[model samples]
Target: MDLDRFTRQSETEWRVAPFGKMRVPAVIYATEDLIRDMDDKVFEQITNVAMLRGIQKAAFAMPDAHWGYGFPIGGVAAFDPDEGGVISAGGVGFDISCGMRSLHTGLTPDAIERHKSELADALYRSVPAGLGSTGKIHLDPLEMDAMLEGGARWAIERGYGRAEDLERIEEGGRMAGAEPGNVSDKAKKRQRKEMGTLGSGNHYLEVQRVTRILDQTSAAGFGLHEGDTLITIHCGSRGLGHQIGTEFLKKMAIAAAESGIELPDRELACAPINSPIGVLYLGAMRAAINCALANRQIITHLVRAAFARIFPDARLDLLYDVSHNTCKLEEHWLDGARKKLFVHRKGATRAFGPGHPELPESLRPIGQPVLIGGSMGTASYVLVGTSEGMGLAFGSACHGAGRRMSRHKAYKTWMGRQVIDELAQRGILIRSPSSRGVAEEAPGAYKEVSGVVDATDEAGLARKVARLEPVICIKG
Candidate 1:
C-alpha cells in the first residue's frame, strides 16, 4: 500500500524489486488510493508467486488485486513447462472457472421499465439461486460426463441455447483436453442437479441499462448502445468446482515435496507440470471449465424462457462469456522466440487483443470483451482488449471491483434488510433467499468499480466501451 515500498515504472505501473527468495520481480497496475487501501497481504502473496519455479517475466497483479489464499486474488503469472514449471491448485480458488457472461436483449430501458417489477419477479422465480439451490433438470452419470466433455455445445445439442452462441464464448464454449474420467465421482454427484443453478457468494443475474459509451467504435462493434437493456449472468461450476478444488489442493500439497517443489507457503500447494498429480488436476480442471460453460449456457436458456413468458418478442443473444481462475496454455513471444507457457489468471479476466487467432472472426477487428462485474447495486462496465495489453500481464485485466472488506466484516457492519430497502429506494430491485447472504455482499464492502476500470484502461489492460447500471438483481 505504501508507495514507498515500490518503484514507479509508469503512471499506472509500479514495480517491487525482488529480494530474499524471489525469482522474479513483482508488478502491479493500480492508482495510489486503491493500492493504499489494499491489504498488505497482497504484496506478500504476489512476492510468493514470484518465487515459484519456472516463472516467466514478473508476477503481476491487476488494479483489483486483493489478499487471497496462495496467490493474490488478482494475480497473473506464467510458467514455462520446458523449464519445469508447476501448477498450483491454490492459484485457482474454490470456485473454479467462476466468471461473468453478458447477454444482449433487443430491447430498451424504457421497454423494461414498463414491467420492471413483473420482470424481476419472473427472473427470480425462473432462475434457481442462493445457497444449496437445485434445478428441475438433473443429469445421470453418462449424461453428466457428456456435459463435462461437451460444455456449452452439449447444452445446445440438448436445445438449451442456439448453435450460433458458441462463437461468442471462450474456447468455442468447450475446452479441449477435458477428460471427464479424471473428475471424481463425488464432484459429479454434487453437480448432478445443479445444472442451471446460480451458486451463492458474489454471483447474481442482473438486468442492466447501458448508461454511457466511452468508445463509440468499440461499442458499436460490441452491439452495445446507450439505454440498451442487457442481462448479465455471474456464476460458475457450482458444487463440482468446489469439490475439485478441495480434493486437489490436498493432493497437491502432499505431492509438492515429492515433485521437488519448495513452496514458501503451504497454501500454495503445487505439482510439477509433468507430474501425474498435475496431469490429473488439469484434466479435472478443464472438465470443470466445461461444466461452468454449460451451466451458463443453460441459464441463458432459462433467462430467455423467463423473458419470453413475460414478453414473447424479447430476444436475448449472447454477447460474450469468459472464465477467470484458469491456467491456460498460450503462446507468447518472450525475448525473441515464441514460447508456450501456462498462464494462471486467478480472479483476472483474459483480454485477448485484436487480430489474435483465438478470437472469433467477427470480433477479430475489435478485440475480446472483458466483462468487469460490479458489486451489488453498482454499475458494471464492458471493456475491449487492446494489443498493448497482450504485452502487459499476458493479456490480463481486472475482473471486478474486488472486495474491500471481508464478508464477516460486512455482515457485522450492515443488515441485509436495510441494504435492500436502501437500494430499492434508488429504483434497484433486489431479490435473494437469504438476508445474511445479502448482508455479506453489501455494495459498500467493495471498492469503487469505476475507479478500478479507469485504472485498467489507463494501464492499457483494456479499453472501456460502455457502462451498465443495474436495474434488477437476482442474488445468490
Candidate 2:
C-alpha cells in the first residue's frame, strides 16, 4: 500500500514496473485514498500474477481490490495459450461464476412501501438462504449433468423461467464447452439440493429502489427510473463451485510441481492451458458456471412467485445477469491485432463496451450493464462499460464494494442483533437464518461503494448510470 512503490500515471491509475520474474508490469486503478486504504497483500498478489507465464499487458486490480487467494480479489489478467499461458484455479476463486442479476419490478418505491414487510417475508420463505440452504428442486445424477451442460436454458426447460431471459444473460445463459464428466460426484452431490438457494457469506437477495440516475441516456437505455423498484440477486454456484475449486486447487498444485512451473506463491498453483490438468479444470469450471446460471434462473422464478403472492401485477423482468468469477476465452485487440486469450476475473466484472457483438442488440448502443452491489443497507450502482475500458484492462471493472475487513473481525466488532436493529432504523429490513451472518456482513466492513464507483468511472472502466438503495435484504 506504500505510494512510493508505484509510479502515479494519473489520479486513478498507478503502475508497478516489472521486477523479479515478472512477465509484465502491474497496474492498480483506484483513487489515492482508496489505494492508501488497501492492504499491502494486494500489491504482492497482483505483482505475483504478473510473473505468471504468458501473462499479457499487466496484472491489474480494480478500485475495490482486496487481499484474496493467489490473485487479489478484483484482479484482472489475461494469458495467451500459444505462449505457454496457464490457468490458475486460484484466479477464479471458490465461488465459480459468482455474479449479480437484477430484475425490474415495474413498481415505484412508494407503491411497494406499504407491502414491503409482507413482500420481504414472502421472499424469505420462498427463496432458501444461508449455509447449506436447499431448494425444493432436487437434481438426480442424470438431471444434474443435464443442468451442468444446459445452464439457465436447462432451468427454463424445467419451467423455472422464460426463454426471453437468456438474451440478457452472459453466454446466452449456458456456458459452452462444459464437460459434466469432469465434475466430480461429490461436487454434484453438494449442489443436488442447493439449486435456487442463496449460499452463505456475502450472498443475498435485495429489493432495491432506484434513488438517483447518474446518466440519463444510460439509465433510459437500461430501463431505469428514479423511484422504480428492482430486485438484485447476488449469489453463485453454491457448494458445488467450492467443491470443484477445493478439489482442483490441490490437483493443480501437484500438476504445477510435476510440470516444473516455478510458482511465486504456493497458492498461485496453475498448469499450462494445454496441460491435461488444465483441460480438466476448465471443463469442470465451465460446468460450475452453468450450475450458477441455472441456480440464479431458478431463484428468479422463486422471486417472481413470491411477488405474485404480494403484488399480482408485478412483472419481474430480467435486466441483466453477469458473473464476476471465471477464466473465459475471449477475443481482444492486442498489439493492434485481434487475439484470443484466457481472461481470469476474480471479484471483477466483465464490462463489455458498446457495439460488442456479444452484447444484446438493444443494449449494444449504451453498453453492458455493470451491476455493482453494495453491502446490506448500503447503496449499489448501475454502470455501463466504456469503450476505453477494452484497452485498459480487457474490459473489466470492480465487482462490488470490496471487503475491507474479514468476517471474523467484523463479527467481533458488532453484534448481529445490533446491526439488524440499526439497519431497521434506516428502513432497510434484514432477513436471514443466522444473526451471526448479519454481523459478519456489516456494511461498515466494506469500502465506501460510491468512492470505488467514482474511481472506476474516472479511470474510464465504466460509466455510472443509476444508484439504488436497499428497501429489503434477505441475506445468506
Candidate 3:
C-alpha cells in the first residue's frame, strides 16, 4: 500500500521492480487513492506470484486488487507449458468459474414497480438461496457425471433454457477436456441437489434497472436502454468446486515437494503442467466449470418461470455470461510470435477485445461484455473489452468493487435490519433467508464500484457501456 515501494508508470499504473527470486516485475492497475487504500498483503502475494515458475511477462493486479490465498484476488498471470509452467489451485480460487450472467427483460421500470413486491416474493420462493440450500432436481451419480461433462448444454437438453443461450455463454455452454472420472464421489455428492441454487456469500439474483448509458453504440449492441429492466445472476459451482479445490491443493503441494519445486508460499501449491497431478486437476477443474455453467442455466429457467407468473408478456433473453476464476489454455502473441499459454485469472475477468474470433458474430465488433457486479443496493456497470486491453495484463480486468473490509468487520459495523430498512427507504427491496447474511454483505463493506470501473476504463482494461441500479435483490 506504500506508494514509495512502486514506480509510477502512468496515472493508473504502478510497477514494483523485481527483487529477490522474482522472474518478472509486479504491476498493479489502480488510481492513486485506490492503491493507498489497499492492504499490504496484496503487495506480498503478488510478488510471490512473480516468483512462481514459468510466469510470463509480469504478475498483474487489477484496480480492485486485494489480499487472497496465493495470488492477489485480482491477479493475472500466464505461463508456457514448455517452460515448465505450473498449474496452481490457489491461483484459481475455491469457487471455480464464479461469474456473472445478465438477461434482458424487455420491460420498463414502471412495469416492474406495479408488481415489484409480488415478483420479489415469487423469485424468493422459486430460487433456493442462502447457505446449504438445495433444489428440487437431484442428480444421481450417472446424471452428475453427464452434467459435469455437458455443462449448460446438458441443462438445455433437460429443458432448463433455450438453445440460443449457448452463443451468449463462454465456451458455448460446454467446456471441453472435462473428465468426470477425475471428480471425486464426495464432490459429486455435494452437488447432487445444488444445481439451480444460489449458495451463500456474495451470490444473488437481482432485478436491476438500466439507469444510464455511457456509450450509445456499445449499449445498443448489448441491448441496453435507459429505463429498461434487466436481471443479473451471480454465482458459481457450489460444494463441488470447494471440494475439488481442497483436494487438489493438498495433492499439488505434495507433488510439488516430491518434484523439487520450491514455492514462495505454502498456499501457492502447484504442479508442473505436464505432471500427472496437474493434468488431473485441470480435468476436475474443467468439470467444475461445467457445473457452474449448468447451475446458472437452470437458475435462468427458474427466473423465467417466476417472471411468467407475474408478467406473462415479459421476455427474458440472455445477454452475456463470463467467469472470473479458473486457469484456461489460450493463445496470445508474446514478443512478436504467437505462443500457447495457460492463463490463470483469480478474481479477474477475461476482457477479450474487438475482432477476437471467440466472440459471437453479433458482438464481434463491440467486443466481450464485461459485467462488473457491485454490493447489494449499489450500482453495477456494463463495460466492453477494448483493443488496448488485449496487450495489458493478458486481456484481464477486475471482477468487482473488491472487498474493502472483512465480512466479520462489516457484520460488526451494521445490523441486518438497519441495513435493510435504509435500502428500503431508497426504493430498493431486499429479500433473504438470513438477516445475518444481509449484515455481512452490507454495501459499505465494499469499495465504490464507480471508482473501480473508472480506474479500469482509464487503464484501458475495459470501456464503460451502461450503469444498472438494483431494484430488487434476492440475497444469499
lDDT of each: 0.93, 0.95, 0.94
Model 2 whole-model lDDT (C-alpha atoms): 0.95
Counting clashing residue pairs in each candidate, in order, gives: 0, 0, 0
TM-score of each: 0.99, 0.99, 0.99
Any idea what lDDT model 1 has? 0.93
Over the stretch 89-193, how does candidate 3's per-residue lDDT look in tens digits? 999999999999999999888889999999999999999999877999999989999999999999999999999999999999999999999999999988888
Candidate 2 lDDT over 1-476, as tens digits, reads 79999999999999999999999999999999999999999999999999999999999999999999999999999999999999999999999999999999999777788998899899999999987667999999999999999999999999999999999999999999999999999999898889999988899999999999999999999999999999999999998999999999999998788878899999999988998998999999999999999999999999999999888998899999999999999999999999999999999999999999999898999999999999999999999999999999999999999887898999999999999999999999999999989999999998789999999999999999999999999998
Stretch of 10 with least lDDT, candidate 3: 251-260
For candidate 3, the TM-score is: 0.99
The lDDT of model 3 is 0.94
